[model samples]
Target: MDKMRVSGDRFVNERGEQVIFNGINLVEKDPANDMITPGGDRLYEQLATHGFNLIRFGIYWNKVEPAPGQIDMAYLGRVAAQIQLAARHELYVFLDMHQDLYAAKWGDGAPDWAVQDDGLAFNRSGLWSDSYFISPGLHHAQDHFWANDPASDGVGLTDHYLHAWQAIAKYFLEADNVIGFDLMNEPFPGSQAQEIVQAVLGYAGQRFQVTPDQLMAMWLDDTAKQKLLAQLNEGDTYSAVLQAMTPAVQAFETQTLNPFYEKMAAGLHDLLNGKALFLESSVFANIGVPSALTFTADNSLVYAPHAYDLVVDTNHFESYSTARLDHSLKVIRATQEKAGVPVVLGEWGAYFNQPETKAISEFHIQHVEANQWSQTYWSYYPEFFSSPTAAVLDRPYPQAINGDLRRYRYDPATQQFELAFKTLPGTSRIFVPHLATVELSQLAAQGMRADKRALPGGTGGVLFITADREQEVVLHLQIG
Candidate 1:
């Protein structure tokens, strides 16, 4: 099959079937080393067995171009092997040029030569993301990249980055499963990040009854801010602070981040002519901020945003809150609707496997279904597949729709599934994992005929429904 293409508000395959990309992020992203784990081919098969149809594969720029203007074909060849494996297992691949804190020296991204920090001391906080606000080195490195500053070879940094992506595109141009390129992961705001943080802190203080001067003092004094951050890290909700900062951060995204995306889009225009370009807003956009990205790539763009509750990464799993989730979804959906593009939840679910986390995961999945949006979960580590949470992570979903999907729901407790869509002439397929028993006798749909068959290798079942005309069709699968 030809790779999926963006068609207005959905991804459509060559058959013109709307594809709901369902999968996880697969990356061995450690600061000290970057390598695809051995036996990764088997992992791809494992994902397929669990009914996942996509993998947001992480490809580090540092690994792809270890030196300035160097294109490491050998390293790319290794990554290509993984793509081929995914293709063989019938999975789509979204190549995510992943980064955190700008460089491997700090986290994982641009190589050492690209990190031109103007003599600022490198510092880190207890939380990994705190560096975005506090570390001068990260700010400098990000500033240089955004400015498209010259590297050691006098070639502009972004030019080198684009060339690296071009090479990747050329390498994978023939791979049918290589569906798209996630331009960058959580593109952070540099230089003015501190200002943005301060704006947020000041807003928080005003709402929380703390004085602006005191907030400034706490922001300046690392120990004081860290103490407050520790409270947040311990699951103290800061809804007022996060809500207040939304406009400031959204402004930064509009003023700064969108232009960067435009530059990248211009650079990759020719190379990614037929492929989708997955764009993300600032990491702050994950909470609840309207994205400021408005690009001209009307047909090939996807608003690939991440979402996590405020209590994310805390030791305790906060109970699922519909109001909180609804607010974030409303904000995110408004951004997608404004850009006039399909929304693919690029990443979510980074919590541990506690009872509350399980409920939160279910809530997130429910929203994804309710919104009729595609998503790839946060990750796929070996332990994650074996953990009890996997039961919730892996479930039955409509893989390919013959037409526009109206809504879908799956009750894990009862193993029941329901889907509604406007009918077209093609076959709509739903993945039915082992835990769910969907007999043809239990299937119900109007103006459609349903058939049940085992998936490849007999790992699971697939409910295939064929519709005859252009009308609304509803499918119901009761657990046997």
Candidate 2:
């Protein structure tokens, strides 16, 4: 439960040990549940058993401030209770102010008082996200928010959001496990979204020798959707589309999103203390478009981007493409290099009840390990406890490294976990899930001593390792 801070493009604990956050998001957008994700000891205990060390906890503006100039202490108390529960299991928490179609009226984010639609019309679609493209009301609402329009109290909507963040940070300042705050979730470009979409369509249209209108119709058709997705899977095709959207994406990120983040950071600077600020790219950058977000090196800032396939929400496993996912992640990684900050992939794997996504999960997990980046999967569901994906999720990972981590990987096929790092002065810890039928086998160790101790619930055991000296250390172990 040590406080976390960015250390040269990595997250290090109070002890200065490298920390890798791996867990799931707990977002309960439905107001019917009182705006809190339902869980208790059993949930957090299970998460710990599965080797998860972080939770991107979701909070909503509507619940935090039901009315302008009012802070919802009661609602925050409920949220704090949950954070305390998670902390009991040694899980880190970061508050994510989540949104979808701009406001709670359409999705779950801004309060009703904060929405200014200019009386534009809104029509719901079968796929809730389609509203981003079809609803003029949603566009106008977001445009007003980005413009920082004055509310009934003569306060700007963005200012009100900053006020909400200040109150939340103050409430959780004492919660050691509550590490930081995610400024926003998947910020869309409001009316400018149309421009990006049109640009992409135009780029694709030229390739297919069709007009943008024709391509739009094709995108709307179910059968044509698969073909378009396949076409995009082609390396050159996707790259060109991303190239076409880059200009607009860069414009919005530089002109609007960058300033918004800076304003939020400035507003919260005095209160942040050791807590970090989680920054997310525009929704357009979620796929593969390179983010043009620029920031001076600051220890408190973390680049938290979300990656999703075009076929994410729908159950189209056959249409899933690893190439596309890899391409998108590579783009985000480039942005991280430019921003010179650590990355915690805020959202991924919205597989939702799909038992056949184990391969997809494995690919992503391996990619994350290879890059040495932190991640919290898209969401949590009861099915996660007993799904094909669960087996993949409950794998060995370094909880903390005493020094620079060169590499780490867990090959499920062989039940082997390997790690290489340059040794420092602290004891390194790795989470080894408890196996019902077999004990752990320390196949080899080059320059370190290893010990295993079981956790209270038999969910897993922490493999404690200490280096022999200040040099490169390698470990090879297996759980079978």
On TM-score, the leading prediction is: 2
Find the candidate with the highest lDDT and give its number: 2
True-structure RMSD, every candidate: 3.3, 1.6
Report the lDDT tens digits of candidate 2 across residue range 219-333.
7777888888888888878888889999998899999999999999999988887889999999988888898777767688989999988888876876878988999988877
Candidate 2 has a TM-score of: 0.97
TM per model? 0.91, 0.97
Give the worst 10-residue stretch by lDDT in candidate 1. 230-239
lDDT of the candidates, in the order given: 0.77, 0.86
lDDT by residue for model 1 over 85-143, one digit each (tens)? 88888889889999988888888888999999998967786657766777887888888
Candidate 1 TM-score, true structure as reference: 0.91
Clashes of each: 0, 0
